[model samples]
Target: MNIELWWPKLTPSTRVGLLENNGDAVPPQVVAEVTRAGGSAAIDSDSEESDYYLSDEDVEWIETVTNEEEPTEGLILSKVRRT
Candidate 1:
């Protein structure tokens, strides 16, 4: 599955700058869980879609506080997959 992770703030996190800030990274445990469930995880700085697909549990976690209730029309987000 294609997952889009929204980058709320633009900072520098990874060596390649894939993530803006290390503080905004998704939890490792979450990645492990997704992998264990036969899925892959990747981080993205930009995504175009508004809707996403993931397990119900993960979905619940995804729709958490972005600190900004305002909509992000063109901001980038992370992406995960179920391999």
Candidate 2:
């Protein structure tokens, strides 16, 4: 999924909710939206040692969007399967 395109489409409230609650508290409607946007939820089995490493582009995008040099944990943006 191209998160750059999907991120801008989210409602401001939803975006704030996501940032505040992180992935765990994301509503089903938002999860559906993410799925429809070609994003998948992160599996519990996944680990730092897994193959699903975020690219430099993903990291840069996250930093830019969150405006944090180090983004908080559990962001759905971090879960996006960039293709």
Candidate 3:
């Protein structure tokens, strides 16, 4: 499944922690906290629409956040595939 996370802004430390251990799925508590912080996570599908959207840069930012230790900015977009 494709999971997209949209947030106004997140601290660098928080971004790393979010993807450190969790794979494929993010913890519910994290999701809840993000929601409280004006963020949202939703399934990426052809039919269903999400309240939040990510731009090309936003998508690339997520890739950098997940793959590198360097800090990133803007929204978070993570795509997880289940076997």
Each model's TM-score, in the order given?
0.25, 0.45, 0.38
Q: Candidate 1 or 3, higher lDDT?
A: 3
Choose 2 or 3, whichever is better by lDDT: 2
Q: What is the C-alpha RMSD, rounded to one decimal, of candidate 1?
A: 13.6
lDDT of each candidate versus the true structure: 0.36, 0.50, 0.47
Can you write out model 3's per-residue Cα lDDT over 1-83, one digit (the tens) per residue? Answer: 12233443454444565545433344565656556666655554553644333334534555565565343533344433222
Candidate 3: segments with Cα more than 4 A from true spot? 1-13, 21-23, 43-60, 66-83
Candidate 3 least-lDDT 10 residues: 74-83
Report per-prediction Cα RMSD to one decimal: 13.6, 9.8, 9.3
Q: Write the per-residue lDDT of candidate 1 for residues 1-83, one digit (tens) a residue.
A: 32233222222232123222223444565455545545545554365543222344333334432322322333344432212
Which prediction has the highest lDDT against the true structure? 2
| Tens digit per residue, CA lDDT, model 2, 57-77 | 544555555565344434444
lDDT of 1 at 55: 44
Off by over 4 Å in 1: 1-25, 45-83
- Per-residue lDDT, model 2, residue 22, is 48
Point out where model 2 deviates above 4 Å.
23-25, 46-64, 68-83
lDDT for residue 58 in candidate 2, whole number 0-100:
40
| lDDT score, candidate 2 | 0.50
